[model samples]
Target: MSDLNKLGLAEARDALRAGDVTSVELTESCLKAIDEADALNAFVHKTPEIALERAKAADDRIKGGDAPSMCGLPIGVKDLFCTKGVPSQAASKILEGFKPEYESTVSQQLVDAGAVMLGKLNMDEFAMGSSNETSAYGNAVSPWRRGNDDAQLTPGGSSGGSASAVSADLCLAATGTDTGGSIRQPAAFVGITGIKPTYGRCSRWGIVAFASSLDQAGPMTKNVRDAAIMLETMCGHDPKDSTSAELAVPNFEAMLTGDIRGKKIGIPKEYRMDGMPSEIEKLWADGAAMLKDAGAEMVDISLPHTKYALPAYYVIAPAEASSNLARYDGVRYGRRAQLAQGDGITEMYEKTRAEGFGHEVQRRVMIGTYVLSAGFYDAYYNRARKVRNLIKKDFEDVFAKGIDAILTPATPSASFGLGEMTEADPVQMYLNDVFTVTVNLAGLPGISVPAGLDSQGLPLGLQLIGRPWDEGDLLNTAYALENAAGFVAKPGKWW
Candidate 1:
C-alpha cells in the first residue's frame, strides 16, 4: 500500500475494497505529491479541504460496504468543468474568479461515484491552442524531459494539466474535454492513456463550450484499465444536455479480455503524410505489427478525405467557438473592463474582450467570425461543413468494410520543448493534430496508448479509432496493444 499516490485506478479500487488502505491515506499522499510538484504547474487550484472531506466520506462509504468502483480514489478535474464553488475558468483570463453555483454533470457523476477531487487543473485558454502555452496562468510543464536535456517540455493541450498531473501521479486520473486533439495528443505527449468517446457519449452540460458539436469529455489516466474504469463513471444520459446519448453505459473494463482475435484493424494510407518523421513511421508500423501479433488482422484501407480534416476542423471549430464565446462580453459574470467616462456599451464590449482573451483565443474568434460572415459564409463555413460530411463518410465507408478499428500515430512527433515553436508559423502547431482531427470530424471513438519512445527517450503513442458507440471494442484493442508494447517507463521525476 506504500506509494499509494502512484497506484492506478483499478489497483486503488481493489486495494480499497480489500481494506488494505484508507481513502484518507491515498488522498493525503496525492496532496503531498501535488504540494511538492509546483514546478509542473499542473494544478491551478488545490482544494485540500474539499478533497479531505470527500476522502473521509469515501472511507465511510467503504466501511459501510456500499462503495462504487471509484469510491475513495483521488483524481483531478480540468478547469473547464463547473465544480460548484470552485473556480471554473477554463484557463482563460475572461473567466477569472468565476465560480459556478452548480456542478458539471460529468464531475458530479464522479462525486456520486465517490471519487476525490484534488483540484482544478490548468489548460490552454478556452481550449484554443495545441501547446499549453496559451494559458493565462502559464503552461503546464511536462514531467518528461528529453534525454540529458535540462529544458522544460509541453505536456500538450488544451488538456495539458490533466495529462501532466496524471502522468506525474499528481492524481490517479483527470477529466479532459477534446474538441479536436485536446485529449489524445496530450495523452500521447505525456506517455499516458486518453480516450475521446463518440461525441455526445458524455454530456456537455456545465462543461465550458469550445466547439459544441466537436467537444467530448473523457478520462486521462495512467493506463488503459484506469481510462476504462473512470470513463464508465463519467458517461450517462443527462436531461440537461440535449445532445447526451441515451444508450446504456457499458462496463468497459470488463471488455479488456485482451482477446482481439479476428478483429479487423485498419491501417489508413492517408495517414502516411509527406515528410513524416522516420521515428513516428517506425512507431506506427510497430504498433500495427503488435496488434497483428496479438491475433488481430491488419488490412490496408483508404480514407481519402483525411487530408481535408485539419482545414475543415480549423474552420468549423472556430465558427462554433465564435458563437460559443460571444457570451463572455464583460457584461456578464466574468471579468469586465474598467471603462473611462462616456464609454458606451460597444466600447466596453470591445475593450473588455481585448484585455481579457489571450492571443490564440482572439485569433480563432476572428477567424470564426470571418468564416461565419454573410459574404464568405458559403465559401468558408458551408464548404467546411460539406468537407466534414465527406470526412465522416470516409470513416463510415471503411467501417462498413468490417474494420473494427483504425490505427495511426497519435501525434506527428513527440513532445517539443516549451516556447520552441512560439516564433514559428501557427500552422506548425496545427500540424500536431494531423493524425487526430479526423476522429473529431467523424465523431468517432478514439483512444491513444503509449507504444514506445523515440531516440531522445521521449514517449510516442498509437491511436485507435473505433466505430461509433463501440468504445468497449476500441479499449479492448488498446489493451492488447498495451500488453504487447509493455510500455512501463515512467518519467524521471525532476519535479
Candidate 2:
C-alpha cells in the first residue's frame, strides 16, 4: 500500500473504492502534514474538525457504494473563495471575522463531489504580488531546493499557499483562482501541475472579486491526472454567474488519452527575452521537439501586442478592482475600525479601510481609484481596455489561421528568494505576468506542464494557450505533453 499522504486524488479514490484506506485515515494524514507545514505558513485557516467530519461521511458513502468522482479526497482551498461559516478572508485584516452565509459555487461543487475541505490557504492580499511575501499572513516557501540549499525561497503568489500545500502533501489537490499568472506561476515555483481553464467554464459567483473580469478558478495538483479530475469536477454551467457560458463540459478525465497526433502547435517568437536562462530556453526547444516527435506540427507565430500586455493588464485589473472593493467600505461586510470621538460615518469608512487593507492592497486601491477617477478615466482605463482588445485579437487571429494552441514559458524565470522582487518597483513584479495574463484578457484556456528544472533546481513550467471556451482542448494538449515529459513530483525532506 502506498503512503496515504503520497497519493493524488485519483489514487485516493481507487483505494477508497477497494476498501484499502478509509477516508478518515487519509484525512488524518493530511491534517498531520498540514501541522508539519504550518511553519511554512501555507494556510490561513485550517478546518480540521469540519474536514474530519466530512472525511468520516465520505467513508460511509464509499462503504455504502455511493461515491462521486472525488469522494474522500482532501483539497486545500485558497482563501479567496467564500466558505460558509469559515473565515473567508482574502488574507487581509479588512475581511477579518467576515464569514459569508453562502458557499462559493466552486467550493460547493468540490464539496458536492465529496472532496474534504482541509482548510483555507494563504495568498497575496487580494491577489496582488508576484512573490508570496506580499501575503498578509506570511510567505509560503517553496518545497523544493537547490541541492542542500537552506535559504527560504518563495512559492509564487498570489496562489502561493495552495501551490505549496499541494506540493508538500498537505492535500491531494487544491483550488486556485488565477487573475494574472496566479495558478501557473505558483505551480512552477512549487514543482506541481496546475491548469487555468477557459475563463467562463468555471463559475465565479462566490469568489471574492479582485479583478472580476480576469479571475478564473482552476486546480493545482501533483500531476496532470489529478488536475484533470479536479477540472472535471470544478467546471459546469450555473445560472448564478451571468459570465459563465452555457456549454456542455467534456469529460475531462476520459479525454486524457495522451494521443496528440498531427496537431498544429504555435510557438510565439516574442517570448524569447534577453535574460532568459539557458536551461529554460532548452526546455522550450525540447518541448517543441517532443511535440514534433508526437506527430504534431510546430509553427513559428507572432503576437504583435505581446509587449503591451503587462501594462494594459495592470491598468485594467486595478480599475476593476477599485470598483469591486468599494462594497467593503465598513458598511455591508467586513470589520470597521475605530475613529475619533467626533467622527461619524465618513471618517469611520476611511479609517476602517485604512487599517484593514495591507500595504500592497492599499497601493492597488489607490492606483485603481486614480485610474477610475473622472479626469483620467478615458486616458488610462479606456486606453487599457482598447489595448486589451487588441491583445485578444492577436490570439483570435492565430486561432483563426488554424492553430490548435500556442506555447510559452509559464514564467520568465524560476522561483526567487522571498524578498527579491518586493524591493524592486511594482512594475517589475507586474512584468512576471506578461506571458500568462494575455490568456485571461482574451478569455482563453491555458495549462502549465512541468517542463524541466532551472539552474537553481526549482521547476520550470511550459504553458499551452487554447482558444476561448476550449478547456477540453487545452487539457488534451497538456495531457499529451505531460506524457512526453514523464515529470514526477518528488517532495524534499524539508517538506
Pick out the ten consecutive residues of candidate 1 with the lowest summed lDDT: 422-431
Over 31-63, each residue of candidate 1 has an lDDT whose tens digit, in order, gives 999999999999999999999999999999999
User: Superposing all C-alpha atoms, what RMSD in Å does each candidate have to the true structure?
Assistant: 0.7, 1.3
Q: What are the lDDT scores of the predictions, listed in order? A: 0.95, 0.87
Which ranges of candidate 2 are over 4 A from the true structure? none
The candidate that wins on lDDT is 1
Q: List the residue pairs that clash in candidate 2.
A: none
Model 1 clashing residue pairs (backbone): none
State TM-scores per candidate.
0.99, 0.98
